[model samples]
Target: MDIRWIFDGKFFVLDGIDGFSARTSTRLASDEEIKIDAYLKQVHSAHVFVIDDPEVMPRGEIEGDGLITDIPAIAIGVRTADCYPIFLMDIKGRTAAILHAGWRGSYKGIVKRALEILFEQFGISPGDTVAAFGPGICGNCYEVGEELMEFFPPEFFRRRNGKLFLDLFEFNRKILEENGIEWIVPPPACTYEDDRLYSYRRRKDKSRLISTVEILPS
Candidate 1:
């Protein structure tokens, strides 16, 4: 009943939140500009943002895909509906990431960018990255045609029953694994299949699901 933390313990999901909160007010009710200052950025769903200083809550108006930070206290949040919400943490406990892996973002290789950013910008290695993928639309419920398959190579997308199913979880998991990351924990729930969850695919409507990842004890 208490679904506070997702992926077992990959990151902290503030107590009030359990998976996706439907009326988050981020889009329809509240826009980012009217809501949080500029420090929090949006990604159009493609690049990666890095948060380093935990103390600097600047009001940035940058848009990108993923977020990586070595700042222990600063909590990075990524919003998603049926898209994957992944958290990557290094063993040193100095760096962590909040990644938004949607259909478009996945096609653009946002996860790959995050790993590259860590290595080039922060000197972090892909081998040290441990992944924790939270709930999203499962393959069974995520019904897409061949068009979705073009977003990824043969390895990322697979053929299922003459239809193409996008396994963002498995795709990203393989990504991390191929890059040398072995520690990964995945959630068993599917947003589209579970009525309790908010799924854009299942509902077939326009709504947003809020899956937030934040560091605790600020």
Candidate 2:
């Protein structure tokens, strides 16, 4: 029920609580305590969810790790437990997007796809937009097996005490930079280490934190 962080002058990330849930895709509400309802009333926003399965889109559903929009007050969001939640905003073009990037989604280049959509649809270049990473598993606590090391380059992986850790923040930052985006905000907290945030890696809680962004109405 508590708001974790707000950024880009409009976006917000909510912390997880028991029995707290919101419909991320369409059908906004006002009584769930997720705060999406309050945001909807404030700016008349819409919501969307990212589905991991490709075949699930047939049942009036949408599937993607990222969602972007130029439409004012459309609150685009992505739910994550320990996976990185990234927020992208083009203040000049009045466009914004939110992405849920886990290991698989990141490996598949979810952020890149979001950036391409921003450029193609809103004509907002990478350098013009501001990108920020929200709470997630930090590199120090995020360890992976040897097979996963093949996907990331040497710079993203670190060997400590005979264990491998992946620097997702840096990895995603590189992706943004490679596309010409220089204005990036570092993450505020590590979900695994921060008890205030929900982390699947730390607690294995099925509850997810909703990271969302919506442009104020003109």
Q: Please report the candidate that would top TM-score against the real structure.
A: 2
Question: On a 0 to 100 scale, what is the lDDT of residue 123 in model 2?
Answer: 83
Off by over 4 Å in 1: 1-44, 54-60, 155-162, 204-207, 215-218
Candidate 1, residues 101-183, lDDT tens digits: the string is 87777777878788777777777776665666766887666677777765666665556678777777887787788777776
Model number with the top lDDT:
2
- The pairs that clash in candidate 1 are 38-59, 38-60, 39-59, 39-60, 42-63, 42-64, 43-64, 47-65
Taking all chains together, each candidate's TM-score versus the true structure is: 0.73, 0.75
Clash counts per candidate, in order, are: 8, 0
Number of clashing residue pairs, candidate 2: 0
Superposed by TM-score, candidate 1 places the C-alpha of residue 29 at a distance from the truth, in angstroms, of 17
lDDT of 2: 0.64
Q: Write the per-residue lDDT of candidate 2 for residues 35-107, one digit (tens) a residue.
A: 3311111111122333223333222244456666565545556667778878777756467777777777787
What is the Cα-based lDDT of residue 57 in candidate 1? Answer: 55
